[model samples]
Target: MSIYFWGLVISIAVYLLVGNYAGRKVQGLDDYYVAGRKAPTLLIVGTLVASFLSTNAFLAETGFAYDGYAFLMLALVAVNTSGYVIGALFFGRFVRRSESLTIPEFFAKRFDSRAMQVLAGYTTVIGLTAYLLAVTQGGSILISDVVGIPYGVALVMVWLGYMVFTLYSGSRGVVLTDTIMFLLFTLVSIIALPYLLGEGGGWNATLTALASSEAKPGIIAWHGLTGEGALWSSGKDALIWALMLGASWSLVLAVSPWQTSRYLMARSEHVVVRSACIAGLVLAALYVVLLFGGAAVNLVNPNISPSERVMVWAGMNMMPAFIGTLLISGIMAAALSSCSTFLSLIGFSVSNDIIKSQQWTEHKSLRMSRYIMFAAALVSLILAYFQPPAVMWITYFAGTLFASSWGPVAFMSIWSRRISAPAAFVGMLAGFLINIGAKLLDNAGVLSLPVYLDPFILGFFSNVICILVISRFTQPTKAALAYFETIRQTPKEELDPAEVKKTLIWPVIVMISGLTIAGLLFVFYAMPYAAAVGREFSLFSGESLLSIGYGLSVFCVGLLAFWQVRRVYGRKTAQRATTR
Candidate 1:
């Protein structure tokens, strides 16, 4: 067996050990559900990024970049990362305030409608189940190919690795293990980047080659390859596609059950905000390394067919055995972490929201939740066995479902006083149904929609329209209005002056981070690119603006965190409340 196989086995063994240790703390259902609602910023951020990134990122997204759209993917990033801050501030903190065990339950309580909760739960189960299958199949196939194992055996082995911890420890294990995996892939990306650059004759040579390649005209351009047989035929079409899907994915990060649910485990609203800012920073940085790294692979060999295999080709052929092993193991870890989260949510929802477990005993609830988790795993395993893998496409569909269906409703539930439960239900249903319907129709050649008119876009506008139109005819129930008002209020614990003071370091760290990004961009990226183009660097240059804008976004998000902490926890507000 290859060292890569053993590496994955060892990683899984370590995760299982640590997961079992974390399980010791799960003495009750809430611990299993929300890690006792005491997870700090690091753990929450870890799970958020881990769950969001899977094989889909390394394989599919990187492949897309290698196909000559690194800049476009980065274009998508500008819109996507913003959601972390937006969600943490407006939607996520309020979710913590709802104090609901699950996102669906929050919806149920917010609208005072059991049906809406069940409906929301069903969406979470179905969407996440498809996603789980994609990752599971993707992971198992990766292991089978690399380790020289049978695909069937690999499938079962990979499933058990994650299911074991998730079944027993739930959120506790997922968060802890996710943090470790996040570190692994992150380190691997950093290590692999310079190797790729050097192999292509460093930054200036590689960018110069990519920029001037006749065979790949416009490869690094803003619109990507706009020649014949390209995925996008024109710059206008490419930009439209970016703006459209960027907005859809932004919503996905904002209020998707998988993403926002992590906030439920946060120790406080402050944790929610801080973690989101840090996640935005980490995610953007990682994308630049991996996606740009993906494009850099072309400088070595541009003929790797099925472009998804580009990174894997680099791993096996370019890097050292150990780095290749780590890269493969890192991808496996991504799949496992995402599977753990999706399975936990699906099982937790089935047990808590759908079946309505007996809450009389903590032991009883834990046992019942585990049982449901096992059942969900079995169903997922069967599907994984039968289904063919389309790792990235499946990931894109399953993930974006929440953006259209739940995005508008989730924010509206919190921000819009005029929204009624009936409006919420219809809007949620319309978005899910319409989006799925459009996707199926388009896939089946029954509909002719452009890339910009993605099913999610159709669903999202329909959702908002339904809500706005229906809300005018119906009034929010008194219970719904009361719940909304309650969540809108800041939590009492957040007002502890000493508690707020301890976290004051976060704003400073964030501000310094912004300065660091700007400095690094000027020194590293902009200067190198200017030399490649045979021009002196200027702040007015495109590369400089990209770096400056990224730094400014980070700075502004941190500023929001600072101002929010002050407005909600300053001496005046603290004195108006009880204890400091």
Candidate 2:
């Protein structure tokens, strides 16, 4: 076997060992479902990032950048990641407060609707299975190409690698191993970036060359390529598309079953909030590097077929043996992390929410969940075999299901007093069916959608319309209203005086870091680009504003977070004083 193959094998072996070890502690459903609800900020952050920064991001989305649209993807990401903060603040903390094992159950609890729970679980299975297929396919392709394995065999290997740990250890195993994988991939992303940049003649020369190259004109332009056959009609269209999908994806970050479900494992609401903040920061940094590497690899070799192999090609051809090995393994780690996460969630929904397994004996429930996970993994493997890899689009399609279906309902569930269970159910169903149906039509060429008013718009509007119309006609159930009130209160565990004090530090650190990054960007990124473009490298240049604008956005997020947290804390203190 190649060293890369051995590296992947060893990585899987270690993760298997770690997962089995975690399984030993799974005495009950709590341990299996949500890590006994005791995961700290670090573990939460690790899983959030690991579960998210999968092969879909590394291979599929990065390939989109390599195909031109690097900065456009970055713009979309900046819009999407804002959901982390909004989600953490509004939706995720309440989820932790509810103490549900799965997001489906959270909906069931919030509205007291078992059918809604099952429907949510049904969508979860369908959407996440598609996502799993994409990740598996991406991993299989990487292994098949670089590790010299047949695609069929590689698919099975990828399936078994994640399924073994997930079936055994559940969330306990997933979180711990996910953290480890997260660290590995994060390190490789940092280490591999400079090498990729150096090969492309550093950022300055690479930017100038990409901008000027006649063969791939506008490859590094603000909106990426434009005119005929471009991804969009024009630069403005690209911006609108980025913004539009960016908003949809933002909702995905907010209330996607996979993203919000991780909160159910957090130690406290504070951990949920802190982890979300940190994950947003980490993603901002990681995507810029990862996407840049994707665009930069064109300089190394622009003719890479399928574009998904750009990173792997650059790793093998441009870097040292060990670094290349590590890079491949890192990408593999990302694939496995998402696979395990999605697989475990599928099983949790099947056994817990779909089958109502809590009524069974503890041993039977655990055994059944494992069996269900194995079944889900097998299903995904079969799907992977037939589906030629279209990793990025597959992911985007799956992701839209949640944002359109769950996003509006999620926030309203926490804050709205009148959204009835029936209304929510219709809204969720309408969004799911409309978005998916439109996507199918669009894919089949029965109809085409503009960049701005594509499938997501149809589903999102349908959801909102159904919700508003139905909610107006039907009053909320008393039970639902009471549950809403129940979750709105801060949990006793999170209200500790010292903990509140610690939270104050988060906003301050975030704001300062944003300012520092903005300042550093002009010095490092803007000035260099300006020099390379034959323009005066000045503080007031348009390039400088680009960095500064992003930095200010981060600073604003921190400021808003700081203000809200203080207001909440102040109210809590006053309530206590009045009670005394």
Candidate 3:
């Protein structure tokens, strides 16, 4: 084999060995499912970062940058990071304290109904399956591009790699391997960004080239409905606003069910809390680098599309072979980490959440999970082989469906005392059906909703309305109220000695510091470029009191809202209530 191929093989083998070794202590379904609740903050953070930075981001986002500008990356980063902030400030604490094995488990506990479990399990599995296929296809493309392998062979290899880790170590292996992958990807992104930028030109020169180049690529322009490439446009400003609001809501909502299993596996609530903070920082940094890479691509070429192969093309064309190899490996790492997590998650839902509930023995249950994993992976592999090279909009549709169906159910199950079993059932079912219809319509290209009124937003409101309307007519059972009381009244575990040092102060400091740096970068680098290119941006210069006053007014209002939430919920108590 060539050196590049050898390096790829060696890297994959090393990660697999290291992961399995570190996760050897996972003893049973509990450990496999929840990692024995022993993960530290750093490990939790690493897995969270790796899980979120999946093959989709590498392929889809890069393709977007190639076609459009850095705006797509910037838009998504802002949206997702805002979701993290919302989660940490409101829902993260609650989720950590819930102590449930899966999102369905939480549903069963909070709603006092097995029907909710089965329903949620069904919705979660379906949404996750779509995401799984997306990851698998992306991985297949990467392997085929880098190693010159046939798509079928690459698909099988990817499936085998994921199955091995998921079957043996479960969530334990998922977290450990995810962490390693995150670190590797971070290094590669940093290395690749500079190499690409230096090759293209220094920042200023690159910006000039971009301005004078074909079609002014790299500017935050958009396609309205009457304009070019209008998928469904609100306006030039509509893209950012829709992306920031819609995408942020989806992230928070999806993370609740999607990552709830991993969060429940945390050693302690404090561990998960620290992990969330760290994950946010890593995500913010990763976004910045990706934005830079996207901008660098604009300096080289425009008219790029959002596809996995596009990223590989950019790396190979722009960077040295050695550097390109490393970046490809990093992208592969992202793909593998995401693939393994999906396999484990779907395996858990199918076996524990569905099949094993019919009374399989422990040995049988383990075997069942593995079998299910194998089956799911096989299906994903088949899909990958047949998938078109064009971008798939259904992946985001799946994400939207997940958010709409589970977000309200998750939020109410823990926080709202008024939510009855009927309410929960109606909320989940109504939201799910609406999202499904919208997704199908979108796929059929029949009726595209307005930018702000897409299926996710529609379904989210449907869920809210279902809960509110149902709750008014039907009173909550005393038992359901008692469950909410348990969540609210329970005292949190005291921090361990090691946790005392690692938990509260440093995490806060690090997160704040990271946000500050990201904000500064946005202001100094991102904002200036946007303003120069006829984008809508405002900044305060000396004696521009009007802008300063407006900024302060916005900040003050936000602070007041936060203060009210704190007063009513008692600092992270809203999250605790939601998780309950």
Q: What would the per-residue lDDT of candidate 2 be over residues 89-205, giving only the tens digit for each residue?
A: 889989988888899999999998998899999989999999999999999998898877799999988898998889989999999988999999999989998888897678777
CA lDDT of each candidate?
A: 0.84, 0.85, 0.66
lDDT of 1 by residue, 375-493 (tens): 98999999989887778788889978999999999998888999999999999999999999999999999999987789999999899999999999999999999998998887666
Q: Candidate 2 overall Cα lDDT vs. reference?
A: 0.85
Regions more than 4 Å wrong, model 3: 216-226, 230-237, 244-254, 301-307, 389-392, 490-492, 495-502, 506-515, 522-580
Best by TM-score: 2
Q: Residue-wise lDDT of candidate 3 within 351-387, one digit each (tens)?
A: 8666555567776887788888888887877776787
What's the CA error at residue 533 for candidate 3, in Å? 4.8
Residue 467, candidate 1: alpha-carbon lDDT: 97
Tell me the RMSD of model 3 versus the true structure. Answer: 5.0
Give the clash count for each candidate: 0, 0, 4
> What TM-score should be assigned to candidate 1?
0.93
Q: Deviation in angstroms for 59 in model 2?
A: 1.1
Error of 2 at 103 (Å): 0.8
